[model samples]
Target: GKTHLASALGYKACQEGIETRFWRVSDLVLELEKAWKENQLERFKKKFNRVQLIILDEMGYVPFNKNGSELLFQLISDWYETKSIIITSNLEFSSWNKVFIDPRLTSALVDRLIHHAHILTFTGESYRLKNALSKIE
Candidate 1:
């Protein structure tokens, strides 16, 4: 289901000796912005580079400013084919332009991400809500 599967995948990858980082899209953007403001941008990218897989959870849930969009595009460009990134987005491929803001950037990102990526789409009732309903019954 559409839970924190990205985070779980990251943890599993890390356990298999592949460095991984799990971060929500909003939190990741905020942290990256902070690093930029604090003169730690390079350090932040380095940290990101060390990870074999970076799982970004809840993409498209939060809107991004220009800086955030640029920062995210930079990350995607830097990791293109060199490292794997897993993005869990509520939006479909057609709607990715909304999150990315720029059409060119969105195309580049989709191309790179889909080049060697496996997409798993889940559509159903959320497990949490189903469980809660069962409990009430």
Candidate 2:
């Protein structure tokens, strides 16, 4: 549901000619890993750096490995105060450590992310669940 809202915002940004990119957290991490292996990490980072808005969907849905965590932190750090990032997560601030598995990194990531961020929480049943129920009726 949150991903839907974030993607809608990304779509609107695209329509307005904003340089927006959308990526699922896991998929991004995989891409970054590949870039690192191919010795094009800097190029990959530069590509993301040029975007005005990035919508990172489904953070904390799966825990990241140490390498993935570091790459993600670097991405966040590089974009800090320069671009807008819309992150959709099912976990709260305190539980973020579980995903990163490193307290310090998690803290730093959270600090950079929430520094000038506006958080919007969605409550109630998920859209998928609502749709399934409606279909069954």
Candidate 3:
């Protein structure tokens, strides 16, 4: 549901000629890992730097190893205050350590993300399930 909303916003941004990009957290980490292996990490970072808005979907669905976590942190840090990021995560702020592993790094990442940010929480049954049931009825 949150991913749907975020993607809609990204689409609207694109329609308005704003530079927008969307990536699932796991895929983004994998891309970063590949970039690091190919020694093109800087190029990867530069590619996203100019985006006006980035939607990071499905955070906390997969936990990151230390290296992947650091890479994600670096990406977030780079985008901090420069570009808008809409992150859709099922995990609460307290559970973020489960994903990042390091408490301090998680804290720092949360701090950077929450600064000058608007957070929206969605509660209730899965929208996809609800839609499926409605169609059957």
* Candidate 1 lDDT score relative to the true structure: 0.83
TM-score (C-alpha) between model 3 and the true structure: 0.93
lDDT of 2 by residue, 18-115 (tens): 99999999999999989988999998998876699999999999898999999999988988889999999999989999999999999999998999
Model number with the top lDDT: 3
In model 2, the worst 10-residue window by lDDT is 42-51
Worst 10 residues of 3 by lDDT: 43-52
- Model 3 misplaced stretches (Cα beyond 4 Å): 130-137
For candidate 1, give the lDDT of residue 108: 83
Residue-by-residue lDDT tens digits, candidate 3, 1-137: 89889999999999999999999999999999999989999999989766999999999999999999999999899898899899999999999999999999999999999999899999999988999999999
Inter-residue clash pairs, candidate 2: none
TM-score result, candidate 1: 0.85
Q: What is residue 80's positional error in candidate 3, in angstroms?
A: 1.0
lDDT of 1 by residue, 73-95 (tens): 88888887788888888799889
* Candidate 3, residue 117: how far the Cα is off, in Å: 1.0
lDDT score of residue 117 within candidate 3: 87
